[model samples]
Target chain A: MFEAEVLSGGFSNPAQDSARAFRACLDAMARPGRIQQIAGAVPPAPLSPAAGAILLTLADATTPIFIAKSHDTEAVRRWIAFHCSAPVVAASDADFAIGTWDALQPVSQFAIGTAEYPDRSATLIVECEDISAPTATLSGPGIETTQTAYLPNLDAFVANSAQFPLGFDCYFTAGNQLSALPRSTKVEAL
Target chain B: MTDQAYNFAYLDEATKRMIRRALLKGLAIPGYQVPFASREMPMPYGWGTGGVQVTAACLTPEDTLKVIDQGADDTTNAVSIRKFFERTAQVQTSETTAEATVIQTRHRIPEVALTEGQILVYQVPIPEPLRFLEPRESETRRMHALEEYGLMHVKLYEDIARHGAIATSYAYPVKVEGRYVMDPSPIPKFDNPKLGGNAAIQLFGAGREQRIYALPPYTDVVSLDFEDHPFDPSKADHACDLCGSEVSYLDEVITDDKGSRIFVCSDTSYCTTRQDEGHTGRLSPEGEAA
Candidate 1:
């Protein structure tokens, strides 16, 4: 049953791929702003290596995920459902959402968490074509000194960070490359 | 070889390592609450998941384990917790205090004095001493960094002013060493005095709050009280019906429908041991079974 669910599609060996993806999650969370490339699963079209890696890493029955796009096809849904059993919900009610930034509409709809519990915020896994070094400089608890990421938009991230420990954390996935921006990070536009 | 079917002690090794590292830091600091990324267990919050996690990390094959809830070994929660570790870690279980190397408890410390080589793990529902005062984590983090604990002091003073005695009954707050004012779980103030100057190491875990704190062997733990008001670990001024012990903490039991109260020792094992030796209070009828 585990093989039929986790190994059916493109990933011939699900357990090994899941382990690699989990390592990427640990690295992303531990280092805050550091980008780690994660590749293994050969999921169908829209679901790239980085996106597939994330689904394997964080998605489980406990986590609520949302997929928002016409491109969110049945093959992608079947693979995730069989492997993780993660319930799919609307964008506003998701703990983690996957899609283009535009389809995820009004990022404020997701949970920013309460004043008492900031860690309750949602984590967005946005699919991108390529991730490069943006002009914005980043520094926080996890960073050794300072680093930069080419973000989809500086204004959205700057506004998000202003809330401090009360905003959504994001993971930008392009092909097998993934980078993160925790709420604690300070993003300054150049 | 590890049982590939289950993770180490039923927790992933990475998670155990993270908790183990946090435990070491907590021990070294002595009373400071270290923040950890606590995981969700099959059990509900407000239960003893925190204590379970700590026990899981510290358990070795050679260690004999004991678990208690409200000081009773046979309590349902305690029994369930013991069974979980037994199945996962395959460690030996014990009811005797002296024979056990690790004891996990909720709401009360054991009556038997723990010596060196023993570890007492407290199941904490909430580990923050200042959580009620400041609701926000951002504010509490700053408060801890600055050592601004006047709010806690003011709260205690107000309790005396209103009730003519400190109103806090269990889970009393205490200062560890000289740095961190820690919550001693929900054990009534009566057990507060036993916290400090003990030969055993004490650990506190609050899973929902994602916190782990400790008090090393012989560390100073002062119960929060004013100079004039003073702290008192007060209990019902009655002796145990089965054990004749007056100093042990008591659990108030209602014997009759009219609300007649009988004070019994909270430590069930200790009481049973004493009863076996023919100890009985004046209230217990002669030749009555324990």
Candidate 2:
């Protein structure tokens, strides 16, 4: 064990902290475009607190994670290996992927899942420099009337909506703040 | 303080992780039933094991849990589940519908309107809307994938042909987000309208079926019906005899062997609150003896 690198950043109390983190994630996902704050992880550089916390809460041996080129570093891999035993795989085969908006390039590379099993699609954990303000309109399940959030790429999400019931779900993380955009959301330019 | 005899919420950390992942996928899918590794509970399968496990997964130490059975908080299933969490999870349990963060229900959503922050966990006996029509799981799965809900429409049409109306009073099926036709557990058709555009997240779990599904807040949930027939949310015409509340779902209760009966609000908590506010019906104090 790289005791200092691995053990220092994870949840201090696995049970309680993970529970709290999960609820935050659930609320964020259920109510797309709503920003939330998740605590209890101080992972190595390139991984935000919310992203690290999510990996601890959701990733396990069964999930194949993809670390995008921007955040792919020796320290990040070590932290991931120590905290989550998930196998790292290519973007297309990943159950979950982590990186900034651009680093996760050719977003089409990820699985959009099959018609028979749409839930099998990948969930991208996006690391953002800033995730504030609302720029585009979003209406769908979870959203009351219509919500507005600043998505890095509006056309990508609009295209994603066309694949409704099929596209990949995403979580945008900046520092400790998190927000989500599921496939069900109807994204539009404001 | 709570006893440390069991893990927090009575589930190991790994199990919670698996459930959490499934819940996220379910939310993302919106009314699509996601399969999970359902765990055994101390209670029987019918006794809300699904709802209990869901609550356990969703709960935090800060949450206030409430359990309801057929709209009443005092029923055996409700009491047992509430006590189980109170003992094992050491979380605060509330009887008031407004104060509860997580409400686990066997049947019947509370009469009170839920807000955005609240969550409702439904104990579902059958997670599949087409389970009865198509006995084969594989075919039903394919049908769901292909969005072929003709069988359900046919089933409803047959009901209209026989009973002059769609006779499904309970376990009403609803289409979520115009995508998936979902089973809203065993809630009466009267509560079907409330399922759509709700402020709270609705989670349905079937431990026996090993499935979990969800509807995010304000999701479109349309009860299956024909244009001419229309989905009706009818209830007993009588008001609650004790509380004088005519809007709530009523249960017909027999008074004695003389075949005397009276109607009361199925939601005991709501009825009590109404009564406390001095709302009274035909069976108020002076008129009760008659």
Candidate 3:
């Protein structure tokens, strides 16, 4: 059993909040490395505000989500179940995953989608300590010139970029700040 | 119509979320079409149900929307879509391209350069650039996966072989970010260059085909062309007879029974704006200054 407090604090206005949260997520994803602020949901511990808001906005009954061990608390699970109504599943079978960079290790295990339908790939919501680290150089679509960000690592993302149209996309969140790193982005250590 | 009956924008929240997810994924992978479970809008598929759905998902109460067909806001289809949004979303509508936050377009991009906050949603009949050469979906999927664009190159080469120049004029294919080959809808090749490095976000929806793709703000989009025979974006070398705009795309209109014709700017708003600024052309009223 979980505390009632953990399950109760979802978006006050589901429709409007979700819409606003989604637009924030969309903006961040479209312009990779650009940070955007998002709010609405205050999920349980270990789940950042941005991550929780994203989960509430994007995850639903249809999407199977995988919660990493660091964030796999009863409170987090209860919050997710109550708000998103999404079934928690294994990373391999998940359409979305939530955790920190370390907890989501072996990212290769997640679905990168198939040739016929690359949209089947997984989207990960990674909780980070800071989004403004400014440690890597990013360039590609959405970027007119190279931009910098504080990525968890360079090698893994570069490897992921090499996969091209067949790699999982990622969102990095810290508190209410969010930024995305789509597979299309070219990441290099600064 | 009572607001209680249907959800905002006429789409259920679940459907919007689904489309939103697909849209995010599409933006993540520029120019690559992401398959979506398109819903049955009140309109038919070919008549921009896809663009409608995409617009519905993106619209907020504060957004000012513009709908256009062949770059004209007064066209039948454009009027219909504008009315649909005004009725359902209860949002302000604009005929001027500069004022719109979200512009849903069929066939052509607006002549005015888009700024940072605007979003362009395209109504696409066919989203696959390789559909003509290879009919099989499975084969085309593999081709996209393997980056096998030999067929497209050969087709362009054959066009040059047949006609001294590349013959494709509309629905010109572009490679986005040097990865996926994307179909920039049926916009004339003249607009293909506009697809790249634009400040506004570009979204493409193909309802009948159940596909959605995107080009994020400032994305790199290069038209497919050979080195020697570079892609040439050429339009009829004629200025609008009414607006006198030389750079805008012109539509040929028959003026008389004796085969007399005049060219007018396809972008009605751009033409009207120019005219309001006191610009007159050969076809303007006799009293107006040239």
On TM-score, the candidate that comes out on top is 2
Superposition error at B199 for model 3 (Å): 1.3
Question: Which digits, one per residue and each the tens of the lDDT, describe model 1 over residues B17-132?
Answer: 45654654455345657778888886898878898888877776667899999999998899988888888777789988888888999988888898866888999998888999
Which predicted model would earn the best DockQ?
A: 2
Q: lDDT by residue for model 3 over B171-216, one digit each (tens)?
A: 9899998888989999999999999999899999999999999999
Candidates, ranked, lDDT:
2, 3, 1
In terms of lDDT, the best-performing candidate is: 2
Q: How much of the true A–B contact set does each candidate keep?
A: 0.00, 0.92, 0.74
Candidate 1 is graded, for docking, as incorrect
What TM-score, over all chains together, does every model reach? 0.60, 0.97, 0.96
Candidate 2 lDDT score relative to the true structure = 0.92
The CAPRI-style docking tier of model 2 reads: high
- Chain B TM (all candidates): 0.95, 0.97, 0.98
**Candidate 3 at B284: error in angstroms?**
1.7
Q: How close is candidate 1 to the true structure, as a TM-score?
A: 0.60
Compose the digit string of candidate 3's lDDT tens values, residues A1-190. Answer: 3567676768887766787788888889878898999998888788998999999888999999999998999889888988889999999999999999999999998999886677889999999999987999999888878989879988989998898788999999999999999988999888
Task: After the best TM-score superposition of candidate 2, give how far the Cα of residue B210 lies from its true spot, in angstroms.
Answer: 0.6
Q: TM-score-based ranking, best first?
A: 2, 3, 1
